[model samples]
Each structure stands twice: as C-alpha cells, then as structure tokens.
Target: MLGALAQAVERLPPARRWLVGLSGGLDSVVLLHGLAQLGGRVGSPGLRAVHVHHGLHARADAWAQHCQVLCDALEVPLDVVRVDARPHRGQSPEAAARHARYQALADQMAPGDALLTAHHRRDQAETLLLQLLRGAGPAGLSAMPRWQPHGSGWHGRPLLDMDRPMLEAHARENGLVWVEDDSNGDLGLDRNLLRHEVMPRLRQRWPSLDTTLARAAGLQAEAQELLAERAREDLQTLRGEAAGTLSIPAIRALRRPRQRNALREWWREKGLPAPNQNRLEALLQQIRDVGPDSGLLVTWPGAEVRGYRDSLHAMAPLPLLDPASVWSWDGIRDLALPELGITLSAQEMLRLHGLEPALLEPPLTVRLRRGGETCRLRGQTRILKKLFQEAGIPPWERDRIPLIHAGDRLAVVWGLWCCDLPAGAGRR
Candidate 1:
C-alpha cells in the first residue's frame, strides 16, 4: 500500500504545500498515515492536514480532537475549521454538510497548495450510481476527477485507484484507529442506502462491480472532454458584443442536440450550475419565441439566463434593488452599497476623467436611476435612457447603475458616463 501510495504521490503536480483532508475516519486516517511515511523521501512539500468541523453530528468536536492528535503524532501542522452545515430550503442534509466541509477546507488553501482526499474506487462507483439515478448527462456521470484546479490551489484524490479493502488492510497492519460516523448506517441517506444495502447485493453477483463502474466513469469523462472542446470552438464564433454573452442567431443556427451541448458547456465555462434537461428545453423554446430587441428570462436555482437584443446572457440571479432607494455619500470615506455588491470610493472617482472637482465635495447623494434624469456628455444634454441605449447597456442594468448627484444635476455614473465639466469649473 505504501509503494502504491508513493507512486501516486509522485504523479501529483508540484505544489508549494500539500493539505490532507483528515476526517478522522478510516479512509482519511490511512491516507494521512501513508503520506506521513513518505514525507522524508518525497521532498516533503510543507505537509499539513485540515479537518472541517461540520457541527452536524454529536461527535463532531471529538472528531476534530482525533484529527489533531493524529496529526500531532505524525508531526504535521493541523487546522480545524468550524462551519455552519445547516441545510437550506430544498437542500438535503448530506449536500449541505458536504458543501460546508469542502468550503471550509478550500479556505485553508493558498495558491500553490493541493488538498488531498481519500476517495477510493468504491467511492467513485457509488458516485456514478448516484449520478445515474439522477439521470445526469455525461459531465455528471463522469464522477469526480482525480485532480482538478479549485479556488486558488487544487483538489486531488490520491487513493482513487485503490479499493477500500486495501486501505483497511494497511490500517490494520499499522495499528491505526479511526472514528466511525454513526450516520453511515442510516439508510435514509441515498449514499448510505446504496453502500450498506444495494451494493453488497449487487457485488454478490458481480465481485468486480467497483472496477467496472469506475471504468465506465472514465469513459464518460473522455466524452465530456470532447464535448467541452467542441463547445469552446463554437463559443468563439457565437460570442456577443458583451463579455460572456452568446449570440442568439448563431445559437439558433445549430441543431437541437448540438445547441444543448453547447449551452451546457457554456454554463460550465462560466462556473454556473448546469440547467436540467427540461429547463434547457424550455429556454430553447423561449429563445425561438423571442423577436429582435425583445427579451425573456429563464430562471433556475443558482443561475438565470436572459435573452436580450440578439444575445443570451447567463449570470447569477440578479439581486432586487428599489430604484427609489437613496444613500448619502460624504465623498471622503468609502461608501458601501450592499445591494449592488460593490463599494464606491471617492478616491477611485478622482482618478477618472470628466468629474468636476466640486463633485468630490461633501453632501453628495447616491441613488439608482428613477428615470427622467439627463446628463451633459460631449456638449450634448441627453436623457439617461438614450445614453444607456447608445452604450449598449441592457435595460436590467440601467436601474442598477449608481448615479452620483450634485444637487439634482447628475455628476457621474459609476463605471459608465461622467457629466462633462467645463474647463476650470469648480476647480479647487
């Protein structure tokens, strides 16, 4: 087991540090032990361990203590992160815990660090079965990759090719003890049901089920790569005037299957959640109904797609903002606009062109456009709406753009047009 693990560690890309995800469970404990043995020989890259305290189980604190002790014995630095793992509406408990755990671990990684998990062949097979039951497409069926770039660093599974029995044998030979999460026996959870009941029955008939399913997942991964490559090629031709927007007519030119493939790939590239088949089909139907300059919005959890003026724009669901809301700015301190997810700084404004020195004075009012506002740009007094149209700013964004006011006349529009000031006017 040590020899196989050493070879696997050698295959990992060079990194400034390696973070082992120590859950205090059998699999993780064995993985950390093996890595500790290889530390002196493998040019040990700042070996350390992190354990996420999900606080979901009764023994969650105990688990953290166990991980600390184990890391201490191995002379490894350990970080225990506490996270809120409570499930949100429509989200399963398992999913919430997993999300929280990974998020906590990811926070501990730096640019050149890699987080290793002890996911073996059985885990891969179980993931494939779950994806299959969910009727997922090629990308989902591919299961987890051995390693992938995540956050500022990378995430890897070094024990991906090994079986659970192999890890158990190594643990026994080395006198290793581990904490067993009681939740694993709960049949209510889908993964537990599959592992404790369904898999054993299936394995009775097919002893090599894990290897077979893992192979199938590998093939699906290959298919996903090809699809992603094609999508990248198609996107270059279908790009719209705006960044991340797709040309509607170009998409319409493709056949239905290819359109679906390209759309999924586009979502992947944007790091947005993939739309289910029904949602994708509905979006396509709505696209066909859209006329030039007319628009429609399709929404699902975590993301939304909007068709506007011959383009499809995908993004996180837009936050609601009241156009009548107002904020006073001192023009000295940074102003926080939580609703807009941005901060406005007077210093940043001073670095830009077309701003009157008086615009940066005290008593400035900041608000969204309430319509009928006009500004002078290039010696022409134009309505804000017309200016937005000329600038190709979408209607949904017009109301969200921050308008800085000096008593009723517009002084500046954040990130867009600034009112033209006469030479030497309001200069300090």
Candidate 2:
C-alpha cells in the first residue's frame, strides 16, 4: 500500500506540502502510518494531518482528540477544523457532512499542498452504486477521482485501489487503534444500509465485486473525458462575442444529442449542475421560442441561463439590489457592497476612470442606479444608458453597478463611466 501511495504522489503535480485527512478510522490510521514511515526514510515534503470536526455526531469532539493523539505519537503536525454540517431542506445528512468536510479541508490547504484521503476500493464501489441509484450520468458514475484540483492545490485518494480488508489487516498488525463512529451502525443511513446489508449479500455471490465495480467506474471516467473533449470543440464553434455567451444559431446547427452534450459541457465549465433530461427538454423548447433582442431567463438551483439578442449566457443566478438603497461611506478604506458582491476602492481613481481623489470624503453616500441619471464622460452629458451602451456593457450588469457620490455631485461609477475631476481635486 505504501509503494502504491508513493507512486500516486509522484504522479501528481509538483507540491511542496501534503495534507492527510485523518478521520480517526481504521483506514485513515493505516494511511497516516504508512506515509509517516515513508517520510522518515525518503525525506518527504511537509506532511500534516487534518481532522474535520463535522459537529453532527455526539462523539465528534472525541474523534478529534483521538486523531490528535495519533498525530502526536507520529510527530506530525495536526489541524482540526470545526464546521456546521446541518442538512438543508430536502438534503441528506450524509451529503451535508461530506460537503462541509470538503469545504473545510479546502480552506485549510495552502498554495502547493495536496489533500490525501483514505477512500479505498470498497468505498469507490459503494459510491458507484449510490450514484447509479440516483440516475447520474457518466460524470457522476466516474466515482472518486484519483487526483484533481482542490482549492489552490490538489486532492487525491491514494488508497483507491486497495481493498478494505488489506487496510484493516495493516492496522491490526501495527497495533494501531482507531475510533469508530457509532452512526455507522445505524442502518437508517443510506450508505450504512448498503454497506451492512446490500454489499455483503452481493459479496456472497461475486467475490471480486469491489475490484470489478471500481474498474467499471474507470471505464466510465474514460468515456466522460472523450465526451468533454468533443464538447470543447463544439464550444469553440458556438462561442459568441462574450466570454460565457454562446451563439444561438451555432448551437441550433447541431443535432439534439450534440446540443445536449455541448450544453452539459458548458455547465461543467461554469461549475454549475447539468440539467437532467426533463429540464433539457424544457430548455430546448425555450431556446426555440426565443426571439431576437428578447430577454429570457431559465433557472435551476445554482445556475441561470439567460438569453439576450442572439447569445445565450449561463452563470450563477443574478442578484437583485435596490437602486434606491444608499449607504454612507468613509474615504479611509475600501467600501464593500455585500448585495452586489463587489468592493469600491480609492486606488482606481486613475486606473478605472477619470475621477478626483479628493471627492471620496467621509459621509459621502454610496448609491445604486435609479435610471434617468446622466454622467459627463469626455465633456458630454450622456445618459447612463447611452454610456453603458457605448462601452458595450451587457444589459444585465447595468443594475449591479454602484454609484459613488460626494454630496450632490456624482464622482465615480463602479466598472463603468466616471465623472470629470471635482472642483478642488487635480486631474490625472
């Protein structure tokens, strides 16, 4: 197992640090020990152990303490990140915990660190079956990846090829004690039910179920890679004038299957969820019904696809901020607009627009656009709409621009047009 893990680590991009996710379980304990032994002989990178405290179970603190003791014994640095893993409405507790665990792990890693987990072959098989039951496509059916970008670094499952019994034997032979979560005994959980009941029954008939299922998952991964490559080609052809927008007529030229594949690839590129078959059917109908220069919005949980003119844009759902909302700002620091997810800084006076530095005095109000407003850009009193149109700003982003005012005079606009130099302030 150590030799296999070493080969996997060597296959990853150059990393200066390694973070091991120590879960205080038999599998992770064995993994940590194997890595520690290798570090002593070969002078490995800065290796540290991290235990995520999901705060969902009654024994969560005890589990953290157990991981700390083991890391101390091995003389490895350890970090414990506590997180709220409460399930949202219509979400499973297991999914919430896994999401929170990965988020916390991503936060703890540095620029060139790799997060290593102890997911073995049996776990991979269980994941494949779970995704299959959920009607997932090739992307989900690919199961756990061996390595991928995590935060600013990388994450890998080094023990992915090892069987469950092999890790258990190593722990027992090396006198490594581990804490077991009582929640695993509850058959009410979906994964527990599969592990305790369904998998055992299947193992009785087919002895190499884990190995074969994981192999199937690998084949699905290969198929997904090919599909993604084809999608990339379609994207290059269908790309519109903007970064995210795609040409509607270009997409219409492809067959339905190719269209679906290309759209799914776009969602993946945007880090959004792929539309299911039923949603895709509705989306196709909507695309066909769209007219020139029309505004249409199609939304799912985390994504929204909007059409304007001859282009289609897919991104995170646009936020709505009041144009009448106003706040007082001090000129000493950058002002943050929470609703719009942007910040206003004084350093952009000359960089972004022709604004005066002295205009950002304290007690000045930060306002949002209320329409019918005009700005003097290049010595012309132009309507805000005209200025935005001339700059080629999209129609959707006009409302999100923040208006900076010093008393009654408009000083600067966020990422758009700016006013001329104020009376007392010098021009750049």
Candidate 3:
C-alpha cells in the first residue's frame, strides 16, 4: 500500500506543499504514518496535516487533539480548523458534517497544494452502492474520482485501491492508536446502511464484493467518458451565440432521449449539477410549447434556463436590474459597468458620437428601454418595436440591446440606424 502511495506521489507534478487530511481514524492514521515513512522516497513535499473539527460529536475536539499529537510525533506541521456541521432541514447529519468539513479543508488549500484524503476501496464500494440505490445515472455511479480540482488546489485519493483491512493492519503493525466513531455502526445513513446491512450480507456470499463493486465503478466511469464525448459532438450542432446558452431550434430538432442526454452532457461539461429528470422534462416542454412572444424561465439552485426567440439560454439567475434609474455618463471618460462585466470605453463612445452628431447632447446615458419606446428614424419618428422588426434584430435581443440616449431624446440605435451621420456622409 505504501509503495503504491509513493508511486502516486512521484507521478504527481513536483510540488513543495502537500496537505494531508488527518481524521485520527484508522484509515487516516495509517495514511499519515505511511506518508511519513515514505517521506524520503516520495521526495518530501513539505508535508503537513490538517484536521477539521466538525463539532458534531462530543469527541470532536479530542479527535483533533489526537491528530495534532500524531502529527507532532511524525514531525509534520498540523493545523486544526473548527467548522459548524449542523444539519439543515431534510438533510442527513452525516452528509452535512462531511460537507462542512470538506468546505473548511478546501478553504485552507493554496495553489499547487494537494489535499490528500484516505479514501480506500471499501469506501469506494460503499459509495457505488449508495449511488446505485439512489438510481443515479452514469456520472453519479462513477463515484469519487482519484484526483480532482478543488478550489486553488487538487484533491488526491491515493489510497483508493487499498482496502480498510489493509489500512487497519498497517496501523496495528505500527502500534498506532486511533479513535473509532460510534456513528459508523449506525444504519440510518445510506452509506452506513449499505456497510452494516447490505455489504456484510453480500460479502458473506461473495467475499470479493468490495473488489467487484470498485471494478464496476471504474467501468461506469469509462462509459461516462464515452457518453460525454458523444454529447460534446452533439453540442456542436446545438451551439448558440452567447456563452453557456444553447439554440432552442437546434435542441428541439434532437429526439427526446438525445435532448436529455445533451442537456446532461452540457451541465457536466460546465461542472454544474445535473437537473432531475422531471425538471429537465419540464424545461424541454417549455421550450417546445411556450409561445415565441412569451418569456419562459426555469431555474434551479445554481443555474437557470430561459427561452429567448430561437435560443435557449442557460445561465446563473438573471440579476435584478435597477430599471428605475440610468447611469450618468460623461463624454470625457469611459464608464466601467461592473454589473455587466463590460467596460463602456471612451473610444467606443467617441466613435459612436463621430458617426452621429445628434448623439452628443448633454446628460447622455446608456440604459435599457421599456417596451413600447419609440425613436425617430431618418425623417419620421417610429415605434422602436417596428424599427426592430425592420432592422431584423430579433425580438428577444431587443431587451438586451443597448440604446444611446441624449437626456429625454433618443439619439442613435447602435448597430442598427443612426439619427445623423458625420458632416458629409448621407444616412443609408
């Protein structure tokens, strides 16, 4: 096990820092000791131990102290962080605790640092079973990966191929003392239920249950990769103009199964959570049945999908705009619009002014117009709605399109028509 860990460390990009998560449990204690013993062989990445006190159990502080003592004996720097792990309504206490603990550890990581955890084959088998029972798709059934990016650093599960028994044996061989959580015996949590009830029975019949499940998870991961590749190819056909958005017409052209697969693939590509089957179905229905003029929006916790003309836009929730006010702009300098993540530079504004002299009036501002606003085109004033239709700018883009205004008078409709031109040039 230690040899495999040494090889894993050697394969990683050489770094001067490594943060090991020490839970003072048999698995983590063995991991810390193995790394300490293999220090010279692994090229010494300035190893340090981090213990997160979830504060859920009464013995949390003592467990943290034990980790600190072990780290001190191993001559590795130790840091202990306290995190609130109170469960929210409808959430499992174990899951909430783990989430809080990992979040706290992620906060401590720096760039190029690796967060090493002692997840083994047993844990992998349990995870796979839990996900399978939840009726998860390929991505979820793939279980935890060996390595993944987390914040500024990477998370490494070097002991993933090793079993719990191997880690316990190593700890016993080294005469290491570790605490066993009482909650591990509880069968209320899904993983615990699988471990205490289902797995024990399966292992009794097939002794290699853990090994088999781990292998199954690897196969699922490979299948997921193939599906993702196919999804990427399909996404090329559904590409839209804006980032993170998809073309509604193109999406509607796909069969229902392919559409759901494409949506799932898109979310996975963006590292966002996949919507439930019901939500995804509803989204597809809205795209197909909603009137072209009606605004359609479907939102989840971290993302949203909206239909705009022929495009289906998926993004973070639309920010609430202060529609009652307009930003003051001076012709002398560029205005930085942080809300839009865009800068209205002086050069662009000057270029606009040079194109249309009528746009130079005082109190000139940039703002979105309410529906039914009108502007004069050439010799006659026309409703902006008709002007957009004539210009061929789709109805959906009208709300997002920027209009240059001079106090109460509308100047030029950018990229469409100019109220006036430079001295000698005639309007088209």
Full-model lDDT for every candidate? 0.88, 0.84, 0.78
**What tens-digit string does per-residue lDDT give for candidate 1 at 327-419?**
987776788998988888855676764444344444688989888989998899999999999888888888888998776668788888778
Q: Which ten residues in a row have the lowest lDDT in candidate 3?
A: 419-428
Candidate maximizing lDDT? 1
Candidate 3 lDDT over 344-386, as tens digits, reads 6556644664443223666777787687777765667789888
Error of 1 at 372 (Å): 2.0
Candidate 2: regions farther than 4 A off? 1-14, 40-43, 330-333, 357-363, 376-381, 389-391, 406-411, 419-428
Model 2 weakest 10-residue run by lDDT:
354-363
State how far residue 166 of model 3 sits from its true place (Å): 0.7
Task: For residue 60, give model 2's deviation from the true position in Å.
Answer: 1.1
TM-score leader: 1
* lDDT, candidate 2, 150-204, per-residue tens: 9879998889988988888778788999999888889998888999999999999
Clashes of 1: 0
